[model samples]
Target: MAHTQKLEMLERDDYLRFRLPEALKERFKLYCYLKGITMSDTVREMIEEVLKNEDLEKLLQEKLLQEKQRENSRDETDD
Candidate 1:
């Protein structure tokens, strides 16, 4: 005898909807399915990644400035 797995049904109206190009929608759905995540979750993750990348870029710029200052100090000390 095989056991059946029970699945929960999410209410459609409870979620937001939007329209996209057919090709883009299909590709996004396929990617989401492969990652075992819902399309909404995938979109949310993408937005988070963009925000995190912006923060990382700002930090990198600060570090670069600090490195340049250190190089200038070393040059003055050598002179």
Candidate 2:
């Protein structure tokens, strides 16, 4: 007799849930299945990639400074 792989049904207690549109969720599920990957692995890799994006951080900081400058200008106008 050959050995069979047992399917694991227990969810990870440490896992987090993210909400997505139904169509997009289905597409992502199928994509991961075809790529022989779990959703967790794909999301983890994407998170790591975004966290490593220095340009994104710089852009966000620039936007934050612009917002603060605008707020200061508004306060000056009101004074």
Candidate 3:
């Protein structure tokens, strides 16, 4: 016969805070409501997934390159 023991986990009281545009916040709130999911869990899952990615650096570099290209296009349009 084998015996098994359950492990207890500690409660998480930490918070991650950031700012976003009001319109974006409202959209995210509505999306969560429609999906019947809490905002915290959605954000936590996204964070965990990002942390687990092995190609995060390449992903970040691609994002930065895209942003820079957008900025350049905007500058050209503004000229």
Candidate 4:
């Protein structure tokens, strides 16, 4: 019963795909291999770490506000 529930939860998880430079990719692969961890697990842990960081959220919000201000400035110049 527990095994079936675990499988169901995993099935519901989303798949993420992205690209990286070849050298960076190779280095990450080697790091994971040396640590005896799967690349996906390592990436997931890193993502969780970032999500837990309060400063990251604040930084993202600041970046978004700056972008909106830039767009508004451009619109004003065009008018």
Best by TM-score: 4
Model 1 alpha-carbon miss at residue 8, Å: 23
Whole-model lDDT, candidate 4? 0.93
TM, every model: 0.43, 0.62, 0.55, 0.65
For 1-79, candidate 4 gives per-residue lDDT tens digits of: 6999989988886799899999999999999999999999999999989788768778999999999999999999999
Q: Please write out the lDDT profile of model 2 over residues 1-79, one tens digit for every residue.
A: 3233222334333667878999999999999999999998999899889888768878999999999999999999999
- Candidate 2 lDDT for residue 42: 97
CA lDDT, candidate 1, residue 72: 100
Candidate 2: pairs in clash: none
lDDT of each: 0.81, 0.85, 0.87, 0.93
How would you order the candidates by TM-score, starting with the best?
Answer: 4, 2, 3, 1
* Number of the candidate with higher TM-score, 1 or 2: 2
Candidate 3 C-alpha error for residue 48, in Å: 0.6
Ranking by lDDT: 4, 3, 2, 1
Q: Which stretches of candidate 1 lie over 4 Å from their true place?
A: 1-19, 55-79
Clashing pairs in 4: none
The Cα error of candidate 2 at residue 29, in Å, is 0.3
* Candidate 2 ranges with C-alpha deviation above 4 Å: 1-15, 55-60
Considering every candidate listed, which one attains the maximal lDDT? 4
lDDT (C-alpha) at residue 8 in model 2:
33
